[model samples]
Each structure stands twice: as structure tokens, then as C-alpha cells.
Target: MYTNSVLQTDYPWTKTPLVASAPMLNIAMAPLAVSVSAAGGLGFLAGGFDVSALESNLEEAVHLIKQSSAPIQETYASTAVLPIGVGFLNWGADLPKSIAAIEKYRPCAAWLFGPRSIPDDLRPWVEQVRAVTEGKTKIWVQVGTVAEAVAVAEALNPDVLVVQGADAGGHGLAQSASVITLVPEVKDVLTTRQVKNDIPLLAAGGIVDGRGMAASLALGASGVAMGTRFLASSEAKIARGYQDEVLRVSDGGSNTSRSKVYDRARGILSWPVQYDGRGVINKSYIDSAEGGMSDEENRALYKEELKKGDLGWGPNGRLTTYAGTGVGLVKTKLPAGEIITNMIQEAKAILQQLKA
Candidate 1:
């Protein structure tokens, strides 16, 4: 099993049972990332499919971190590396710009995901990032299956492995097991293969609160990475209607389904065939899956919805509301820092009670 000590050594200021915000493209921006890190957890800013804004985003994050409290500033005063992390979608990210931003800003971690090909597509990214940062920026790869975990571990040897289950939001493998089975299985396989045991595993998917965090820790994860839970954070770069819908949904298991309908409707077809997104089931999904709505028709409707702004999202709205199965657990919009601290405290209480 993995332990939080591994993460603590890499991120000296982080607290135990590490809570990290998943870099939900465009949503997890500078404020959210900085706030989470300031609260003694890891926060990540999405580098997005395009790397054009990455440098500016990092600059803003740097400014925010400097303006942070004395403790946060002092902790990072000696290191040139930024405390926050940046996540990239390998399939569409421009390698040159991505490498340049990483080289310049040197965020504590670079989370690589959605590669068109395993190991092969990831090698240059891993090598170049390490070379430019001199290992200051840790490599964290998000994998959805045991095969990817093993392959990446054996070949790339990422500093951290984020095991994303099928229940996760945004983009991930269309067919993958839940974190309950995936985390332990990956650990067992890596151990049996004599891979580096010190590499920590971060569980992602359907983890919203302390209960979920405690359960993940018990399942052999050193930490938890939450995307959906952070969607409700006040710092999240989300629209009013989208956030409201995130709070309105319940029984995540029934309300959210994995499909490419939303992506197609939004005109984003660059993702690999095996990958799909999990989001709230809305008219857009229903129209395509059941109503037999043509792709062109759905795309046209989605365009109109975009003009409606906040009104564009909801059960009947045509806009995309990508979220995880644990969306129900996120009821209110709170500061990213509060969410981090509260979850850590809640997890601690639950663990102590369990021991008792």
C-alpha cells in the first residue's frame, strides 16, 4: 500500500491524506489552484487542449501565490518551482508551448492525460519536462486501467499515478473499473512486477467528501483527486446554471452516464476513440441517445444554447454539464480552501472513529 509520506516529501507543505483538485480543463484556474495549495492541499490548473493560455495562467498563479499568506509564501520562498500543478491533455496539447510554459514556470507537478498512445506518446513529454525542470516538477500521469498503470510505470516511471475510475467526470476511458477495484489491483500488479514501490497512487472519481476520502485511503491510495467536487467551488471558472445543475442533480449513478454525445454536440471530436465523458444526463444526451436526433441537429441546438449563457445548462438545457457520479455530494458553493480544509478534517474524524 502507498502512504502520504511520499507525497509529503515531494510537496513539503502538503498535509496528510493529501487532497488534490483535478485539473478540470478551464474550470480549475489560478484562483482555485492557489487556494487549494494555500489550504495545505495540492491544486492544479488545467493547461487545456491548447497551451496558448498556459503561460499567462501560470503567471497569474505565481502572482496569486506571492500574495498568499506569510506561511504559504515562506514555504515556497526558497524554491523556484510553483506550488501548484498544471494538467495537460496529451492528444491535443501543443508540445512546444507546453514544454516552454513548464520550462519557464516550473509548476510542482505536470499532470499528463488522454494520450493517443501510451508510453510512446508520453516519452518525450516525460523526458523534456524532467530535463527542463531538473526534476523539480514531478510527473503525474492519470490512467484509467491497470494496463496503462503498469505500462506507464514500467516505461515512464511517473512521480505520481492518478487512478481515474469510470465514475469520474470530464474525459476518461469509456470502459474502466471503479476506483475500489482499480486502485488495489494496480498496487498489487506494480508490487508483483517489482516496480518502484515509493511512487504514490492518487485515487480519482466519485470522491466528494471526507467519507469518500477515508474510503480511498483505506483502499490503499495515498490521496484523492476530485474533479466534480471542485466544480461547486466558488473559485471554479464555471457558469451559474452549470453550477446550479451540479447542485441540483442526485443519485449520480442514475443521473450521469458516459457518452460522446456532449462532445459531439459541442463539436470536439479530437478525443481518442476509447475515451468518453461522464456528465449529467440532459436533453442533449437524451435527444441523441433516444430521440434519434441527428448529429447536425444536436450541434445546431447546442449553438443556440450557448447564446443563452447561464440558462444554457440544466436537465432541459442543451449545453454540456460534464460531472462525475458524486455530483450529489456537492450541494453548496464554497471557497476552494474551505472545501480542502473541511474535507481533510472530516476524513481525519472518520478515520479516528473507525479506529475507535
Candidate 2:
């Protein structure tokens, strides 16, 4: 029975800093959620890619939050935080099951991605989420375009709008602007419409450090939604091989690129053509690109890679490693709480220096 969280609304994050960990399928799990919450940030459970484990994950998130540090413990007594949240992909997949499961958890907010158009295309899902949350839980919508963000911000009672840039990991709009170029445009539109107080803008993509967070704020984003950074968190439920790949490619993050390589390998060709994602440019992707291997061969390679367990990643590894261009900032595999706290501290220092 937690009260309202300081972060659950459009309040000034001047002292508390609003940082959120983006939900990554097969990666963001209970420990990750708890750690983020304990750090006084947003912890969103990954509710997309399938709903089979939704209930268990949400339950585990609660369990971990309860067992976490004092900030989260106080959330249960006061209204400073709701402990955890959940996110879902609404573009190519069905959302009913995911929605149903998360509705019971009563998360602080529900994040929805792939809103082709807002209020109109997203209303039904929003309505369902409202009904389940009794309109108490806030709505956080993610969009890749300024047009989509403006429309959604204008028509809905959304609490937050996540502007995902083309540099993001996982599935993202194939044709989208870079974070630096796109965030300000979205901010201008929202400010012009006078919706800044109602809908806070969060910049997502290639950002994994305090410098990026500070830069986003300077560009008009209220916070940063980081996915790749959390993928390196010690609590992330990713394989060791996956985590290593994330760290290995950290040389200014030039080792990754946007492509549909994983979707093709996994037979997930249903995503709209406009949506593609960034993945680590591994040996398999290079080989498959030159028609040197068949789909069957690629699938076989993926299977073998999975069989090698957590330590099995290299040139021959067939795992789908999604990462951002800013992977270079991810220098270590630290705890999620440590990452959030350090990022906030670093941002504060940078902002202070600029003020000086």
C-alpha cells in the first residue's frame, strides 16, 4: 500500500532526478527492477515479446522490491515511489494478455511502445490500462517521431512521453531521427502546445551515462530512458555471453548497427517494415548478409550458441545482441542501483559545472 510517488507525476525532478530503465525483453527481470527502485529511479519490467512469464515476473519484482534497500522500503510507507512498472510492445504483438497480467500488479505506470498514431490507435489499450488501474496509474507512451509525440501529448492524459531515437537497441523505427536532433524538436512541439506540465518528455536511445542524461535535459528532455546501460547491470537477466558482448563493443560503440538481422534469424518477420532494430554486428550477421548461409543454417547456429550457455559468445556466436551506439559509456557490469546512483551524481556534477 504505497502512496503516490514523487516520480509518478510531472513534478520537478531537480533534486530527485528522473531516470528510468527501459524494459528489454528477456533481459529486464525482477532483480533489475528492484535495484532501480531502490536507487530512487523507475524500474520497468519487460512485458513484451510474449506474456507467458508476465505474472511471475511482476510478482517477483514486488518480492525483490520489498527485500531491497530503504528507498523502496519507504515507498511502501510513503508515496515517494511505486517500486516498479511494466512496458509492452503494441505494434506487431497482441497486448491483451500482457495488459491483463500487469493490471493486477498495479504498477506506477504502464509504458506502451509502437503507437502508430496516438489517442486514436492507442486509445483502446489506454482505456484498458485505465480500467485496470482505475485511472490511478499513469500512462507512459513511447514514440519515435515528433508527429506521433505531438499527437499523443495533445490528445491524451499521458504522464510521460518517451522519444526513442533511431540509435536505440531492440526494435525501433527504421526511419527515425537521431536523439540529439529529434528530442529538441519534440520538446519544442510539446512546449508550443503548452503540454509540458502535463506530459514530460524522456529521451531514449544510445544514452547510457550521466553525460548523455545531462545532454538530453539540455535538449529539452526531462529524463533519460536507458536500455543498453541496464543490459550491463549485474542484475539484468541476460546471459553472460550477452553481457560480455555489450562490454566488448564499448569502444565508442562502433560495433553495433541497426538491422533486421535478429528478426530474420528468429523468424519474426511480422514487424512493420518501418520498424527495425540495432544489434551487435557479429560474425553471423556478416556471413548471412553475403548469402553465405541459409536461414536453416543461421537457425542452427543460433541454437548451438544458446546451447553453449552464458560464456559462449564470439565471432561464431549466433546470439541476437542488441545494443546502442553509446555502448562505449558502459564500462563495467555493476549493480543496477550503483549505475543509477552514479549516473545521477555525475549528471549533478556536470550540470553544476555548467552553472558555474
Candidate 3:
């Protein structure tokens, strides 16, 4: 069976039942990524559709690592790879630019998602990143289905597989199972196929607290990656209104829904058709789905709300509030480091209690 030992070996500095922060666009920037790493959890900075900011972001992360306390420095002293990882949306990413950034920054891992085609589109990225980083950088491919997972494993043989469920926030497959079923199914398929390498699986989607983390481990995940949970982190580069909405919302099952509505309103139409994003429901969604508002009209109003700054979010607010089904569990805005450490402690305690 899969175990945390695989992850501990890959990421020597991390604690057991590894916790990672999902790379959210414009939010999981240098500060949040570095802070998560310092606390012994892997953190990923979102490379987004555009990679122009990647080098500058990595530079800032390097500076932060250098200025970190001795204990944090010691955790990273043994490896040449940067402790934090960088994630990319492959559908719209400029491969050459992304490769250039990875070549220079040499992040520990590259979390890839939303490719136009499986294995075919992801091949060059995997080969080139490995070539440039001399295998120092591990490739992490995200998939929402068992077929996609098996295809990637057979072809790219990625170092890690991030199994994202339908409950996840931001971009993912519109039709996908929850982690409760997806993780084990992927594991079973990969095991049956006898993929040459034992690629570690990291479960993502709807997981907000230590309870979710422990449950994922029980379901055979090597680690858990949380996006919504970190949206409430103090270091997340999110607007006050957006962050406040994330904390204020509850019952993510009913409050959040997956659709391309926000992307259309924001004029970001580059994602693959199969992919959609999960976010808190608001006036914008209501006006479009129920009130029969046109995309053009919604876009216009969204732009107007953007100018309102912190007032643009909430039930009545029109701006997008991308979050997960577990948004209700994320009630506090703690430091990213504290969030990681606390979750790890709580997950361990819960797992121990279950063992007894």
C-alpha cells in the first residue's frame, strides 16, 4: 500500500501525512508559499496563464527563504531544490516561458493542470522540465478522473499525481467524483496497471481541516492539498472582500457551484471545455442562471463591481469568490505556517485516536 514514507523521502523536510497548499491564481504568491514551506508543508505558487511574473515571484520567494529563521533555513539546507513548488494551467500557459522560469528557479515540483489533451499536451512540459532541472524538479500532474490518471502515469510517468475532485475550487473537470471515491479509484487503477514508478497521490478538493486530512490518509492518499482553506490565510494575496466572503460562507455543498460563469465574466475563456471552476454563489451567478442575464451584460456589471474593491464580494456582491465545498470550515485567517502546522497536529491526533 502507499504510505507517507514515499512523500517524506521525496520531500525530506515535511512531516508525516503531508499537507500542501493548492496554488490559487493571484493568491498563492511568494509570501504564502514560502510561509507554508517554512512550517514543513509543501506550498505551491500559482504560475497562472501568464508566466511573466514567475521570475519575480521566485526571486521574492528566494529572498524570503534567505531571511527565514535558522530552523527554517536548516530544513532546506540539505537540498538544492527550492522548498516550494510552482503550479501551471497548461491549457493557456506559454511552455517556453514556463520552462525558462523552471530552469532558473528550480522549484522542488511543478504542479500541472487543465491541459487541452492528456499526456499529449503534458509530454513536452514533463520532458523539458526534467531536462532543464536535471531531474531535480519533480512533475506533478493533476487529474479529475481515473482514466486521466492512468494515461498520465503510463505516458509522462509524473513524479506525483494530484487527484482533484469536483468539490475543488477554481478550475477542474466539470464532471468528476469527490476525493472520497476518486483517490481510492485512482490508486486501484495505478496499482492494477503496475505503473513502473510508485507515483505519490495527493488528494485535493473539499478538504478544509484535520478531519478531512485524516480521512484522505485513510482513503490511501499520501498527502492532501487545500486551496479554500488557504484562501483564508493571512498571507494569501487576496482582496479583503474576497477573503472575508470565504470565511463568511458556510455549507459549501449548497453555497458553492462549479461553472464557467466567473471565467466568462472575467474574460478568461482559455480553459478547456471540460474544465469549470467552483466558487461561492452570488448575485452575479443568480443574475445569469436565474434572471437570464447575458454573458456580455454580466461581464459589464462584473467590471463595475471590480472598481468597488472590498465591496465587490458577498451574497449580494457580483465579483467572483472562488472557493470549495469546505469554505464553511475555514473560519479563521491565520498565518499560512500556523494553518499548516495546526492541521498536521490535528490530523495526527485524529489518526492516533482512530488507531486506538
Query: TM-score winner among the candidates?
Result: 1
Local accuracy of candidate 1 as per-residue lDDT tens digits, 1-356: 32567687789878888989999887999999999899888999999789899999999998999999555577668887899999999998998899999999989999999998865558899999999999999999999999999999998989999999999998999999999999999989999998887579999999999998999988889999999998999899988899999999999999999999989999999998999999999989999999999999999999999999999898989888999999978898899888888898898898889889
Candidate 2 local distance difference test against the native: 0.76
Q: How much does candidate 3 score in TM-score?
A: 0.97
Which pairs clash in the backbone of model 3?
A: none
Pitting candidate 1 against candidate 3, the one with the higher lDDT is: 1
Q: Which candidate should be chosen as best, given lDDT against the real structure?
A: 1
Error of 3 at 86 (Å): 0.5
Worst 10 residues of 2 by lDDT: 1-10
Each prediction's RMSD over C-alphas, in Å, is 1.1, 3.7, 1.4
Residue 44 shift from truth in candidate 1, angstroms: 0.5
Query: lDDT scores for all predictions?
Result: 0.91, 0.76, 0.88
lDDT of 1: 0.91
Clashes of each: 0, 3, 0
Per-residue lDDT over 93-155 for candidate 3, one digit per residue giving the tens place of the 0 to 100 score? 899999999988889899998899865569999999999999989999999999999888998
lDDT of 3: 0.88
Better of 1 and 2 by lDDT: 1
